[model samples]
Target: MGGINLNGLFIKPPSSLLAEAYDALDPNGNITIKWDIISWTPDGYVAVVTMFNFQQYRHISAPGWTLSWTWAKKEVIWTMMGGQATDQGDCSRYKTSPPHCCKKTPSIVDLLPGTPYNQQIANCCKGGVINSWAQEPNNYGSSFQLSVGAAGTTNKTVKPPKNFTLLAPGPGYTCGPAVVGHPSKFISQDGRRVTQAMMTWNVTCTYSQFLAQKTPTCCVSLSSFYNETIVPCPTCTCGCQNNDTHPGSCVNPRSPYLASVVNGPGKNSLTPLVQCTKHMCPIRVHWHVKLNYKEYWRVKVTITNFNYRMNYSQWNLVVQHPNFDNLTQIFSFNYKPLTPYTSINDTAMLWGVKFYNDFLNQAGPMGNVQSELLFRKDKSTFTFEKGWAFPRRVYFNGDNCVMPPPEAYPHLPNAGSRLKFSIFIFFMTSLTLFFLFE
Candidate 1:
């Protein structure tokens, strides 16, 4: 280079910004400030203060000293345009005396699962143009700053960091609507296979994703089958015929079957209407619930509506969880439903309820009851909010047996009795048809 004279100078150092207290974010992606200041004047610049890293330094630049800056580490003069150049005794090269504390960046920390955190960085420069630095943690955490300039400052923030927690399906969960039969029914078709069913789950971003990925199909392994047989038409007259009725001893309407279930949440009631047919009885019920994953870890489900209907019609329900064992329960109030009927699940920390009514053979009064349950794990416990009922869906499964035709109506010996039957025949016929089609 030809002879060059310097009028002013600036310096730039490599620096980066990083989360001061990050749980697991790497340091490379952060931004940093790199800068230096200088002056060139005949007085050789008497330094007042020195700022290392965040610290400040003496006054920079003078009337005669023109200043410019670029990314290059060394000073690059744009032109010899300034007045007279004077020796400034290298103002950029100042040293601190006495016991000096080494320059240090902000402190940081590693984040933990489900844990909340707070972090901040302060500006340390004494004077000069300093830009505010940006901070971004792995979780898009919030940022704050501390300053010594103001006496009292107030801040308003919304949605502060929340605590972390893990949740699971309540105790004793199982899969319903297995390939073969109801809960008690075994997979006789296959080997005496003892499947230690454990729940597993995969999340889909959209409803389409759930369908495309076939999650419902893949999750079948978590289900189990059971046996339930519907008794063929066993007729019983409830005696109430349409107009001009004639009541008899044989035609009596029995009380409806009551179903009560107690689980993690609470108690729920269901009234099942009995439909006695010449060959069998059938009922339909549906239930759906959305779980709140933010609430608790485990949940429980218990069904108990099989008082009298159990003897005539065997029914069962299947309970399932994403990452847990499948439980199957028989709807026989006389005894415990079965081992497979109850469950608590944690597999994918899921939320939702699926109802498969009389999965094997549908024979019974039709209706259902759902209740809240409580779950516990370690020191934390969870329960459904008080008195919330799981919504129900009522429809017949395709496999359930239909009621008998009305042609099999009981024949009477006297015309009066026959005429009475005829009077009620139209109404009775309608009732019979409803069951048959159902």
Candidate 2:
């Protein structure tokens, strides 16, 4: 009979025992769970399970459990411990061992009779589990508890979605609704709540909009003291003399002494006729380049009236360059009308400047006009040692100036020429000796 009884107990499946345990749980009773703050720090704290019970059942499997707390009336803290078997202890190190045999704290057997179980929860919060809890102890004082069972049992009270208010105008001039990627946040006046939203500035300029030809206006502050009030939009143009009467208009007709030289005939071949006429080639342009900064250069161009007999009434000069990544301010002296134009052509940048003067007083016989141009280039593509090969074209009154050729080096005789000269000398000597002998 004793042998039969032992055999019967051994033959009973483990599943039946598990079923019995599940049925013993009271469906109407709450699964009571208790938490205790074991250790605390300024950043966070270490918490443990002091006691937990489900009817009289000591072993219970509660997976997808969560602990939550209200923080600072702004943030809701949640700590999740994924699916775990309480009979074997939630500790990963002793997961295969029975709860009573688990050395780690928070063992199921340790908390079976409402006894406190000490163990550190892993990945509880942002700055480590313990540090995260200690970060705001004052906030944790309000509502800090643990829920055992499925994830649904945890507090999931949804708060109102945050809204956004424009603090001030962004780098862009206009503002609109928030965007997805760009997030911004601001605190309330009482500092109790924080408003967060994905904000984006309005489109300031687009590819098609910039390509369109229109008057460009810049936002300028009216008063230096306060950055408010959009100043009147002024039309921008490239030219000298920006007055109310001649706004955005360059002075035309550069010079008055723009006439060709003429030769007068002598009167009756006896009295010589003196004639003073303007020459077509009155101005001579001299280009001077000097390294200013890293890859920047100061190009000083001097226009001199080399002709001592004629004066230039109007003149126009155009200078070009290879690259103009950043063109500095242009400085011109003795020239009234000047305009700088920059355009992108293919892969290179084309920069042109027209220097003109309507009055002849600025340029007279033996007079000179000077202007300085500053520009930057790619260091790898441009260097002072390689020499400035730019100003691909320079036009003086529609005529391109001919660039002077580089200086030539002295010629030297090679080995082949020396051998040929030696052979000729040998033949000449042999002929002279034969004549002498004869």
CA lDDT, every model vs. true structure: 0.21, 0.29
Q: Model 1 — TM-score against the truth?
A: 0.15
lDDT per residue, candidate 1, 1-438, as tens digits?
121111111112223322331111122221111111112223111111111121011011101011111111122111111011122223233353311111111111111222322221222111121111111001111111111111111112111111111010011111111021111111222445432111111111101112222111100000001112222222331111222452221111352322321111222212222332221122322222323334233223323222223221122222222312221221221111112112434211111132333223212233343333322223232222221222111111101112223232222235676578777988899999999999
Model 2 over residues 47-133: C-alpha lDDT tens digits? 232111111111111111222121222221123131122332233443343222121222121112122223222222211111001
TM-score each candidate. Answer: 0.15, 0.25
C-alpha displacement of 10 in model 2, angstroms?
99
Residue 159, candidate 1: how far off, in angstroms?
72
Give candidate 2 misplaced runs (Cα > 4 Å). 1-281, 333-366, 406-438
